[model samples]
Target chain A: MTVDFNAIPLSQLSIGSSCRIGEIGLNGLLRRRIQDLGITPGTTVECLRRGPSGDPTAYVVRGTTIALRKEDAYQINVFPI
Target chain B: MSITTEKDFLQELNKEAETIRLSYVTKLGDRIIADIYKNAEQISKNVILNDTNKKNWTLKLDNYLTSKIFGYPFMLLVLGIILWITISGANLPSDMLATALFSLQEILSRGFLDLGAPAWLHGILVFGVFHSVAWVVSVMLPPMAIFFPLFTLLEDLGYLPRVAFNLDNLFKKAKTCGKQSLTMCMGFGCNAAGVVACRIIDSPRERLIAVLTNNFVPCNGRFPILIAIGTIFGVGALTGQLQALAVAGIITGVILIGVFVTFAVSWILSRSILKGEASSMVLELPPYRRPKIASVVYRSIIDRTIFVLKRAVSVAAPAGAIIWIVANTYIGEISILNHLAGWLNPFAQAIGMDGYILLAFILGLPANEIVFPILIMSYISSGTMIELESLAELRLLFIDHGWTWLTAVNVMLFTLLHWPCGTTLLTTHKETGSKKWTLAAFIIPTTVAFTVCFILTQTVRLLGLG
Candidate 1:
């Protein structure tokens, strides 16, 4: 089944969860930077930590730390670990 | 349904597919995997995806930056505009700061005299150390203030990622990470910051490549010396509109050299130290947004300019005082600075610079911005140097010190390629978590600087330009 990510809270997602990155649903550079960090379809990512503001979150994928805004993080679809 | 048998067969097939995927990932081949994943999904969905001929905006943007036709010229033009803004805006404030700071020097000198201090003490404290610090502050502050902000605005504007996107193919071909270009952008603000930015690359090998190549981007601290010399020698050659344009051309040429060395060093490191296949990168092109002007100014001025200035000042003030004392204090017949400069002269000449300039670079390694101040201190304290505050006066000072075209070219080259600052060194150590790589960072640029300058100076002298 195609996973629907809109139902889940982005902040609640755990670290190391494999997910499909979706296209940006909002306007901003930080949004697309998240996608550029390999949050695309079938690309598995591991969430690292919440940044200081707790909106633009940090994650590890392909061994890089990529920070994402909270609004942008929701566009990503993930299946729980 | 023979559940156990069916499940076992499915697991076996899945494991085989997994092995193939793992192999591709190890090869850093993201595109093939992406294609596979996309095709597999299409097959499973039972959809006829014949309409997939359309290219997306993201793909189109990537092609523009990475296109062989547009890439190099685009890079140069963008870099030129940034340099023009930095140079033009820096002029007024640099003059103002020098005037104010030198005026304070006069006040301090009078105060020292009024306190009944001896002439030698007054000379050492006021004329020697204070004047040097003032010169450093006045010259360093404006360029940094202007340059770092423009750079940060670009960063905040999300233009940097596109730059990385454009340069990624080159880096990948060199067996380095695409993100190395991003780190190079950071190096414009400071090499240490660039080193710290290397964390975005996942592979240890590629990260090391990024670290070693970071010094090729001339940092904010090094800008003052390069600009001064470029203006003096390059522009001084011509009069009228031609002079201004020539000076701009010289600065641009020097920057292009730094970038060329960055690519060369990255290529060398990848082939020798960290041999591997090129990685396929999937970068997203963010929609362009209107830059928040206030935020850019606030963050750039406060976050970058003030922060960097504070750090430079903290380290530079003491170094300024020490250089002053060195230049003024006599040992037997020669002052300490003269002796040191004399000692360094042969080696400096071999690299197309004099001992005093080389000494300034060595001392200024702590902060690239301080080289001008150190150089000024050496001259002012050693000889009967003028205490004027204008760029006009500053130009006279360089002319007085026997600065030739060769000296200017060497200074620009050295500024463009040298060891990263102390902060960058420490940051590289932290990011790479390896002392070996950090040492490589220092050695690569210092060696390159010496070789390039040696060739340049010799060539110039051979042609009788020197």
Candidate 2:
């Protein structure tokens, strides 16, 4: 079944848990860029750090550390395992 | 429960159960994955829904401004508008300031004479120091006053992220972090601040690239020199409606050229001296917020405009006074100002600028704003050592000395591409914590400036245009 990552709050995911990024609902370059970073469907992601701003959070995806603004991060649908 | 010692019986039982157990394991995995997906979805949805409720008009505005398509264009347009407004608006105040300050110079000169002050005192105080300071203020103040507020408004609006986005790809291609663009933007106001801003870029190699190239973007202090050259060299070519417009356009073009060269040199450095993979940049475009106009104006004018002006003035005033004294104080034959200019003359000629102009540039190294004043001191004191109150008179004086379009173009190029001033150099040294990089910063731009001027002067002379 197709599931949206936006349905769950990122804060609910404990650090070190692995998840698969589905769709990043953001439109345009930000969406394309996230997908390019291997935050695509079936890719494994691990929460690395929460930023002070409570946005611009970081995650490890496809062997690379990436930071996403909370807004865009919300748009991304990730299936956790 | 068949015993493994009865190998035949165990193998038969294992085969029968394997197919059934495999299905169970697959089902369990899917169920766990599904549950996790549902949780992440719920978390993200709840936060966004809450955000929508709390944020009102301000948040909406921020979103629009920081939207991918609109953000980059908006930032560029705002920057262009600020430059346009500054150039157009500053002209009136600048002329008035020059008129007012020069009149004061005359009054001071008369007061010194009336007080029966020695010729040397009058020369040092009125002709040397006061003239230089007055010239610096008249030329440097207005644009800075106008430009800083507009720039700060963008910063407060949180549009800088979008700027970083637009330039990220180019930086990535250079094998540098995209965050370097933000540092470069910071450099526009001041290279030192830009160097500090480099802390945002995580990779050591990329951060150094940003630091070394920060000075390529001219700061507030250097605007006076550029404006002077633009007004004199480029403006003279056109007539009527085109004249003023042409000047502003050329200056903008020159600034754009500086940005382009910044990227080019950065690319070269990243690929060669700082060889590394392109650091991944996943920048989040912050939602734009409503810019606070009143605060922007206050901070930009008081915090940045006035602050930079104060620094420039403080350094310039003493330099001016010293230059004036040197010009007036005779040592046997030529005054100190003349002797210094004479010494620099040969080297200056090779670089397409004269000795006096080059000397001014060196003396003005403490603060770029003082360059014009130093140049004026050298010129005025080279002869009668009288303080002129009007830009018209200053122009006439330059005309008397045979300054043409070539000199103006060369000056503008040199100003744009020279080494960072003493303060910026120190900032670079401190930021990098390395004398080697600091020296490289100085040498790279100086070399570029020399090469550009040499080619330009040669081309002009070859065309018989000079």
Candidate 3:
């Protein structure tokens, strides 16, 4: 697990940085949805860009861009790589 | 018990069961998903060589397209360019089509008369049905043919998911899914297709919200009307290329209004009858690929353009005949259309449109492409007997009927916000499979259209602009 002292919420990860997902705190639907899209523990996600309105930030996971809102991304714990 | 109360009871029961089932799914998903990926990765490792050195250009392009500063401007520019092309390209073909079809109509009428067809038959079939249907075909076919292909190309190129990413925040604020934006893009082609596209949304509540609010965006049927009005009222003084560009911008602004209203309406629904927490949004931005020219052309032209055209033509045929009957049949020297218009005038005028305009909208319920033609026919048969071709002439006709800028503005707004066409309503019913939701779909937009137009017209009239 990457859930050592370096863990932080995925939403706080800076743009252009990469991270490995430590733990997902979301329950039910969101957890299933994230996992369904290949976002599992130890998966690498690179922060790409934030949208114009800046609520949902896009990240590259498994070579695909997936957008996550702050509230949702806050539930995902990651370690900066 | 009442249906809604029964539904509430059912939902309450389902909530308990749903939580348990979902918990099981989540528990099962963790290990199951991990294993599947592990197996896939192992297989790929054994059988396939990984390409690590992908070119940076696609990545750089994605950054430019989705970056905070560049995202909106690029989206706007792309939309502007597409609309610019649709506007400029559609005009010449539409005029050519109009000329060709009207000539066909003349020949048809001549043959019908030579066959010694009754005057009423000639009137009903030739002047009535053929005229309006021709109007619909001429006006509708070109813009759709041009717009759908371009939209399909962008969609094929996978830019639409970026659009959803770009607008996800605004939609989230409305408590709806980001995928609603993608469906709204489909609505630009046709609302019926838009309703079907709502299936992309996983949550039932959000999907219904999307289907209901999809009509808020102007479809291809309403684009010409907006372009015409925007040209006349917005950039009336501008000439040539400048006029087209200004009209394109004006249209983009009007569509923006629709987007805002979508947020407002979606928010209202989520808070009210369709209340629920926003569902999981996992939008996949697939790597942009080169859109195949042959497939894009085939799908856009055949699947979208022809599909929508068939719906419009089938509806317009009967509607054109009904229009003829109503225009011809009179009580006390007033045609039924005029009577209906006059009856509707007080209410329509309250919302800044007049009798004939409102009547045309009602008749246009079947297919929106025929609304302007119906309005023109009503005006021409009631007032004069001139054949109108160009938007300039259409503007003169509206002005001739005492149309102010307020009327033009309200007409465009009403077109943007009115009820979906009949086929779309039927589609909503089929999709939702509930009469209540379909009825809700109809009532929500219609109510919004009236309220918004009423408020605007009253404010403008108070300002003495009318």
- Which regions of candidate 3 fall more than 4 Å away from where they truly are? A1-3, B1-29, B46-55
Write down the TM-score of every candidate. 0.74, 0.75, 0.92
Screening candidate 3 with a backbone cut-off below 3 angstroms (N, C-alpha, C), the clashing residue pairs are none
Q: Mind giving the per-residue lDDT tens digits that candidate 3 earns over B1-466?
A: 9999999999999999999887787768787888998998788779876444442655777778988789889998998889988888888898999989888887998999899999999988977888988888888888888899999999998899999988888888888999999999999998998999999998899999999999998998899789878987889888878888898999999988998899999999999998998877888877778789999999999998998888888888888888989998999988888889999999998999998999999889988999988888888886645666777888888899999988988999899999999989999999999999999989998999999999999998899877
Candidates 1 and 3 compared by lDDT, better number: 3
In order of DockQ, best first, we have: 3, 2, 1
Writing each residue's lDDT as its tens digit, candidate 2 over B248-356 gives 6777778787888888888899778877776545775444567888899989888888888788778877887787777777889888878888898888887678998
Task: Please list the C-alpha lDDT of all candidates, in the order they appear.
Answer: 0.71, 0.73, 0.88
lDDT of 1 by residue, A1-81 (tens): 665645344445775464444333432343334444544444556665442223334455544445444444665555545
DockQ (Cα-based) for each candidate: 0.03, 0.10, 0.71
Local error of candidate 2 at residue B230 (angstroms): 0.7
Q: CA lDDT of B122 in candidate 3?
A: 92
In terms of TM-score, how similar is model 3 to the real structure? 0.92
Expressed as tens digits, the lDDT of each residue in B222-290 for candidate 1 is: 777777777776676565455545655777888778877888888877777677765423344454445
Q: Which stretches in model 2 have alpha-carbon errors above 4 Å?
A: A1-81, B1-76, B237-244, B385-391
**Residue B363 C-alpha lDDT in model 3:** 89
Count of backbone clashes for each model? 2, 15, 0
- For candidate 2, write residues A1-81 as lDDT tens digits: 755534454435566687765544564455446655546556678875443323344576644456554445666666777
